[model samples]
Target: MDKRGSRRKSAARKDGASRAAADEPQSRVKFWMRRLVIWGGALAVLVALFVGLAVVFAARSMPGYYQLKATQTAQTIVVRARDGTEIVELGPSYGKWLTSDEIPQVMKDAMISVEDRRYYSHFGIDPYGLVRAVYTAATGDRRVSATSTITQQLARNVFLNNNRSLDRKLREAVLAMALEAKFSKEQILELYLNKVYFGGGAYGVDSASRKFFSHPATELSTAEAAIIAGLVKAPSRYSPTADVNAAVGRASVVLRLMKEQGRIPADATVDPSAVKLKEEAGQNSVRYFTDWALPQLDLLLPETFEPIEVWTTLDVGMQRAATASIKSNTPDGAQGALVSMDRDGAVLALIGGTDYIQTNYNRATDARRQPGSSWKLFVYLAALEAGYTPDDRVVDTPVSINGWSPRNSSGRNVGEIDLRTAFAYSINTVAAQLGNEVGFGTVASMARRFGITTEINTYPSMVLGTNEVRLIDMTRAFAAVSAGGNSVEPYGILKVETTDGDLLYEHERNTRSTQLVPDYVAAGITDLLQTAVATGTGRAADIGRPVAGKTGTTSSNKDGYFVGFSSGITTGVWMGRDDNVRVGGLQGGTAPARAFAAYMRYAVKDRPVEQFDTDLQLPEWQLEPDDEYMLGDPEDYYFIDEQGNLIEPGTSDAPREDPFGDEFDRTLEGDRPRQPVPGQRPPQQPQQPPQPQQPPRGVDGAPQAIGDDFLNEATGARRDQRP
Candidate 1:
């Protein structure tokens, strides 16, 4: 019996051991599973904390919902020329801020069909679309669509820049949720449709409609609405302006989507080939002026949500004339720019290039080419301010400062001549001598006082205009001279006002009347400039009016310039290759001066002819053979060689190769051809290569002592106080 009981106990123990072995495995499994669940919960809590911190950090600086809504409303800037002609509309132009009732149902259905099919049902964010996008992305689907609802897109367009990043996405989502909470479904849809970008700088459905169809958004047909709706995906790529075929294709896809969603009938279809696009007017070069004016507008009203109307100083007639002059007169394979302003610094007309479509580079305001002899105005003005008059005698011999020597353009220096003759002839040696005597620092300071904003290196070559300068800044200086020595700040924007006619900013014309150059000094420069235009290098610029102007030509004929003033209008023109390569036979006195004359004829036709304000009667001087020791080599004085390389005293007639070979050729940028009309050259030199002419010496310069009567009659001011 004991043996049987022990065997039963062993059997029971074995059965229990087998059951425990199975249970042991199950217990280990349960312990590991419990640990995994706890760890996962902790990880999830940590992740939640991290995400919460991120959200708090991002939301801390966000604008309040009301402020955001107010600031995000679509605002457009309508830029008008001085005479109230519409130039261009900057920023996203909206149409009347249409209400829900004013919006067309066909447009609404098209937008909802393409952008967000469930836009009405979703609460700012679409979970189903998000899941579908994620699933498709996971499955490597190439056609993965954005998960953002219409509200989210609206939030992004209004409040955020279109940069793809997690932070931006988060901000977009949070803003979208807030927008949904604050605005009703209809209001959100209205804002979305009104503020969405539709390509070619158009912002709203209405702007897109008017821009593409020449009709209001309220008149959009099913086909036009589909075409516009399709632009939302890739506006620039599928804009009708970019590719009509692609736009039609995208519209077909949108129509298919609408049909599949039961928004349109299955049989509803439009023939793509039958579509008619609006014929837009040929865009003009006024965009350059508008472009330059917009930045100034920002300074006047940096932050505003209200629509603005900017009255600019641009004159449409003058602008057209300036463009035509630059195009017809600028040599083939060269580009030109022009800037015209009145004495009060109101920019009347500005052409940044001959054709803005061919190249958008604003040479008038942006390019910093060597001003050539136009810069001499500053040097001579500085000299005049330093107790030198236009009648003062200066030797026009070759000048060497340190190792740099400047020779005259004519390659021959006349004997001692008065400052007026030197200026009218653009005698380089006298200018170099004057700059050194007055000190280049003083010269540069004088330039600053006259509104030259570019960096002026006080080097010897600077006197020769080797330093680069912008055309607008140079033109402003000339304008100051025309304004009777008053300083000028070139302004294109005259006033800024809300569309409701409330003025925000108006330029004070009186503020810029402060005297920058002394009246006596201004008269002296004007006398010289008038002499220059009357019988000097700028003779081509004479328009049978009382004009004071100067011509400028750089080395290798790479740049040509003419800046002058007639009546109260000051205009500057520049022509050159973008690459700074030598333009064969190009000269400031030829193409540039002619262009200036051509434009000024039109610009000043209606304006009254006015004389310059002068108070100094300059005494004429004539140089007689005093047999002064001649300076410079006699042989080098005969003629200017082919290339402008220095003619060393005893060098052969064969042109000396430049030590800086090919360096001058690579000075400027760009590879595309300049705005040049083929088979066209300088108007005057259409057949013959331009020849250097000795500047006319016909003006009275006989050093005759000015009688008090003549001085009193010619200049109303006292002769003793004259510069």
Candidate 2:
């Protein structure tokens, strides 16, 4: 071969060696490719075989799609106040069923936008979303859970226990596919909307819409729908009541997703800041009544777990006012409760605590505390029954009975005051003396008759309200007074009826309105209580109209109370520390009275004003005037002038003689005493006017009464009218 032939041959051999070197890796690649195909096929077979077995077994044992009936069976139990305002819901499931077409299209779009964008296109599961979820999680992304389609969630909610296990997931996936195949998209979406719980005890979009907006699902605004749609991811965390800002943030995300996915137009109107989620009444102050009514359900409806609507006697306006007044006026960390009822003892409003979310201990119905001078009502009522009159004078001096000495609130004794005056000042020493005078046992029996069920110790201190009693019972006692001595039991539920109008229970009108305390006894106590409000310690509770109640401040001020009632309702307010920590300078006339006044200001806004029937019939002894004060010197005459002013015979306007004796002479002199009024008896001669009162001293070692003595507590003084 030539030299050129030799170079070409060498190049060919080098090229052929390079080709062989490349063929070695290519041959090994084919070998491994064959092995990869064989193993990959086997693994795919195993996975398919496992999935097939899971599908077959899950299909055979698949839980029935019985959640529809379950949700239907466990329909929400709605509770309404007397005026038909929704107060709370009672039941495990609180959702209203809706048909496929009834659900709003916008609500459906919002859910699909956030939950599964491909909800309409996918069969059951979204492999793309699942893969994305896995990739993001594997890449240390925050999204770790598997993405569930609407149909999948419906399947899980219907038949699965929400366990995050392979077996459960397989079953959920199989059921999801089955549901998608079995039901229309509208049906699946309807089930999802009607079954998923939005927090605050709301299940389904309809109930959620109503719960948050006080309207039906069809009336949901776009913003509200977005907010509720976000709740599906984390019901508790996204609840507006739990974390409003976080819920609003979640709703923003949902809104953005909807806009981006074209479910809603970018230019579509959405009010992210305009969302107004109502506070859940079930979790608010109204919870006090709902919590109480739960136990009563067993007695109200034992035959069925089906939903029953309880029509409570709660006044929504009064309830809100009470909660607001307590929170605003009460000292921080101090607690308060209020219960208002009609004369018939129908609870108009009840506030268990300042805020139910903080502490649910219902002080109104459950808490027992000393009512200080409020107990004096029973003492005085008993005194009235013991033939003692409001005009019966009692010296408010320090007194000790059986080693128990009660001191006046002022720590200063005001001597020789009437029972009305003593009660007006809530004079402790005088009340103790009255209790001693009228037997403590008598006072206790009177209180029991008026609706106090608590065992009262017949000690002198009980006269100052040392015994503990519930606000409800106290309200009941006052209710008897407001009702003119008719005994009443405080009741919340007016009637309980099934949703289908079957009567479970009805507050019977024929229920006896028995007289526990005598009608006169109630009138007497009510008379004194009104004066207490008008001129004394309970003055803070005055609403510028006729109202009666008492102020009670326990020793060391551990509790304060102002229980007031008008002709229509009796309301009791309690303010104190939950732990019995003394509230410094706190008194029943301060916070409790102010709150009572504030509550009553609203409670009676729509009601007509009426006066308390004091029934002021003068005792027979006072029917006629005393001769010493009226008829003593008949030589002088008196008459009334045209302005209704009493004309004294000796005054400059009258003749300086006995007008009746010289009537003829005065008529001739043209200074005739005003012609005797036809309907009025001739005025008797007036005697020397009485002297200024002096505090009664040790007269016969007992409080002394002067002639024609009758004290008036209404003005915290003596009454010349002597009624």
Q: By TM-score, who's the top model here?
A: 1
Candidate 1: Cα lDDT at 483 = 83
Clashes of 1: 6
User: How much does candidate 2 score in TM-score?
Assistant: 0.54
TM-score of each model, in listed order: 0.58, 0.54
Clash count, candidate 2: 1
Clashing pairs in 1: 620-703, 621-701, 621-702, 621-703, 622-701, 622-702
> Global CA lDDT of candidate 2, please?
0.77
Mind giving the per-residue lDDT tens digits that candidate 1 earns over 1-723?
999999999999999999999999899999999999999999999986876665565456556545643554556789898989887887765555667899998889989998899988886789899999999999999999878889899888787766688998887877776676666888888878877889767777788888888988888888999999999998756878657778889999888888999888888766654667787655688888986887776567756668899999999999999989999999999999999998888899998887754556688999999989988998999998777866566777877899889999879988666778788889899999999999999889988988888888999989888888999999999999998888888888889999889989988866536887777888989988988988789989999889999999999999999999998999999999999999998988999999999999999999898887655633333221111111112232222246633343345755554322364234212211232112212112113223222222223743322223233433555445655
What overall lDDT goes with each candidate model?
0.80, 0.77
